[model samples]
Target: MSVLVRTEGRETAAGAIRPQAGLSTASRVAAVTVLTSLPVFLPGAANGLICAELGWSPVRMGAVLAVYWLASLSGAFVSRRAALPPVVERTLSIALFATCLGLLTAAVAPAVGLWISSAVGGYAYGYTQPHTNALLMRRCAPRLRAFAFGLKQAAVPTATLLASVAMPMLAGAGGWRLVFAGTAVLCGAGGVFLVRQGMRHGIRPGHSGARHPAATRDRGAPLRVGTFLVALSCAGFFGAMVGNGLGGFLVLALTTRGVSLSAAGAVATAGAALNIAVRLAMGWLVGRVPQVAWAALTGLFLTGAAGTALLTRPGLGAITVGALLAYGGGWGWAGLLHYAIALPYAGQEQRATAYSQMGVSLGAATGPLMCGLLFQLGPDAAWWALTAAGSAAGACVLVARGHVGPRPDAGVSPARRRPRDSPRPA
Candidate 1:
């Protein structure tokens, strides 16, 4: 039988058998995520090496990271109610190249280099999600959406892991400039590859790219600001605060406790690896039992809160264990959160994702800056603040759940269902 390629998959002419195209799309999404995420994380991961060269303090490190998060807020404006496939394709393509350019700038420029690099990279980071999430909603099957989101989000920790493991070693071997230059080349190549892969799915390049069937169909009604969205944003904000606040300084904090830079990076690497596993597992589980998604998120938040509290202990063993818990549990809900939003919202995925990103970016920006100040007061103070943020995230999830209506099992939005169809999870 002849193969018929759909927007997201390839099916036999009979339509009973599906090919690997869907997996290919999901893989590309994850790849792009890793590339986009890597730059923001590099500053934190290689802070010791970078700071030694620039003579930067923890506060300056925090500022550089915060600027990236703050710049991400621009995504909301760029992606406002944009449902077209061309827009998604173009924005993401530009974001990728921009990310590479920023890295290249950092590699070559002088003392002010990192600041410029952070802003440019931050802009790219901000523009990435609305498009990527839109692509996922269009391509992935409804049944697998949560898992696909999981796989996509897993790239974040994957990036962190790469940064933790590779950046320090690369800097040590060839200087930090070599690290950014190498990364820029990698990102640039990734962008080209993604654009090519997108062609099969009808996501062509340039201002006049071909449209996907999903995006060409009805452009859904604009997403309105409402209580549920507000609660979701709050949850994201608090969650990011806990995650980024501690995570940004994890290596430095470890070093302060007497671990060497290489050893600290190894610790961070282990934590990131654990985080990757947790996010992937949560995504897989939530995809099957979507009804419990919110509860799962709340549990993760509480678990992370406990983990952050563990950071208050003085021993290296305590610090190591705490970092693992904080990384794995505290920071694992993002994919699930985006999946939950995408599942019910369907057509409004881009706008909805963008809305949430704004809150997340602001919190990420605030968290590191606040934690840097707290670290000056003392590391324990910073850790405690992160613990509080995690607890608050759990509370926000509970509030969001309360607002989801009494029939949690009926996961479909009331407005989306037909009158005769029985209500059920999407």
Candidate 2:
């Protein structure tokens, strides 16, 4: 009897899996960032205006947001087996879905209808993120991974800045509905462009046969346990808690402290801008800094931000600037650590699942609700909760570092590892 065995590391006739030279790493990261940023920046402000105009209660607004998160969590699971071809396909799909939903929501202008559209858009957006990470990991060289991930992270703030500038203009000129319609048009056009670029480069969905099934299969179990999971989850919780939870309330907190609403908004915007800057900086820094050290530094910054809020009554100018820099840098630092540490362990096959797990945990549903409950206790409660969460997340990184030494195989080409010889955590 003759048997056929499939050998790993054999690329399809096209070539070895590598990031397209034409699409430089900077461009690839920028593309992913732009795609992801639109949704993140637009929603909160848009939702608030819609709720007010519709006379919806906090509960109704909260439900709309919660539904979006739930959809994102669901999409994360679906992407694991969905045969996503490349980063471009993922971006195009997300953009198409989001734009269509945005346009439909604008046209319909019904509360229930908008909510449903938001859910669909949110899920599609969530689906795109893991694929972005996978593309960076598999296609880009290992040396560029940290910097690429940071560049991708920077997109969140960049989009937020764009939204901040655009949303108000659209809202003032034609109302909030016009803003949605405009976003839809912009995102759809962007998606179409990405699709064309992807085709030009011959990138499409499905594995390029560069991965070994055995190694891919083994990745599942350790990814579920071990230090990686712990660190990943902790980072997820901390990042989401700050990004979604505290971020939502920052303006309100500043207003309470006697700053005017406009000033508070500006401060918040400044922080977001700082976040983008820090993300870019951290990406370069991650290559030189240990992941544990980044986590620890992020924790210290978070603690100091909380202390500033708690221990001192600095003038609004000082307070806002301090909070903006500290929180923005902290979130950026934590995000970089999470991506750099977790990406290696995920391997090629299970990359989407591993990346999505972080999104699932960090999504708006879990993190914000817990922080909201704490906020209900009092403003101080929220501050304390954030401080504690940051501390805990930092500590977990430290603990995980103690258990897991640097992978001896780190930086070696993935192609070099024999299927049976791949490292498995004890």
Candidate 3:
């Protein structure tokens, strides 16, 4: 079902055999990571407020975002071919510009205008991943790659945390429109910076994989890669279903659980902080025992299910703990998940990452929309639906792991630490 190779490299307390990523490369990766996600959540942070003020139904809200997420998926695929800079520079510039314009549209436009922004923003959101990963694949060292990926993944919650903090302040200062306008300006500047940064760094001519003569091998051949891709796709579908569901709805969900609008934003903020911590933790955890990283999904999903159920109760303490588990535990796997998939197809990390993203986009697009429909039945039912989704997602990952054929490095997993000698037969 799958193959594993001994890890090409790793970093440690002793020293790194592979060269480490220098400060400049690391900073660039981090900056790109943050900028890519920041714009996506600017609108999301105020989703609940928008609904409350306009009396827009969740169904409509979810539908518009579903359209947005789908568009983002397309963006990833589109960016797949344009792997090098200048071309990449133009692509990112266009994407960020579109995001800026879309946010402007959302700020002033009516219902139809909101939908238009959804498509525009979604396109940019989708394109960011493949290209960004491609850059990292080339720049980051094998030893440091997993941690880099994990830290980069933390951008999601960082973006969410910013949105949470900004929304409440912006709403009070100048209403929500000011938030969109301000975020647009930030995104526009970020667009310019992204392109300039690449030029400054002296980007190489070719895309990754084939670009590096040594990395040219299609590490996992067509059938093998295809099967795992399908499996990871299913993983993306359900895992992202849960993660995005929480991201898109946590503040809104908290409000229904008796939280004040202002307080709900705080709860969302707390959840985002915990989410970042867990993603970093997952990075370290997998770096130690990557072969088993896929297995960790089961634990995270179950935690999400428990967390979602906890939220159905009626207390602030429960709400906080639940959000930590749901957001921290449920949503933390993304970085590790992406890293795991990329390790197998290191050469084609960009395109491989895109396949995984398709699963994520599919789930993200539908998760909220499905939950919106469930909310009509009652709030508890929605939580139950999330629980079901988490459970299903966990099963998909476990199944994927099982399908994997043991590679030589399988024994390197921490789980296989049994002693070779049996006490010399005592």
* lDDT, candidate 3, 236-294, per-residue tens: 77777778877777777778766898888677777778888888887767666666576
Poorly placed runs, candidate 3 (over 4 Å): 1-27, 38-40, 48-58, 79-90, 108-113, 200-211, 219-225, 257-264, 288-292, 313-316, 411-426
List RMSD in Å for every model shown.
5.0, 6.4, 7.8
Per-candidate TM-score against the hidden true structure: 0.85, 0.78, 0.80
Q: Could you say which candidate leads in lDDT?
A: 1
lDDT of 1 by residue, 161-242 (tens): 7886787577888987898899989888876665664465442334353434333343554456666667777878888998
By TM-score, who's the top model here?
A: 1
* TM-score ranking, best first: 1, 3, 2
Task: List per-prediction Cα lDDT, in the order shown.
Answer: 0.72, 0.56, 0.66
The candidate with the higher TM-score, 1 or 3, is: 1
State candidate 2's TM-score.
0.78
Please identify model 1 stretches exceeding 4 Å from their true place. Answer: 1-19, 196-220, 254-266, 314-317, 405-408, 412-426
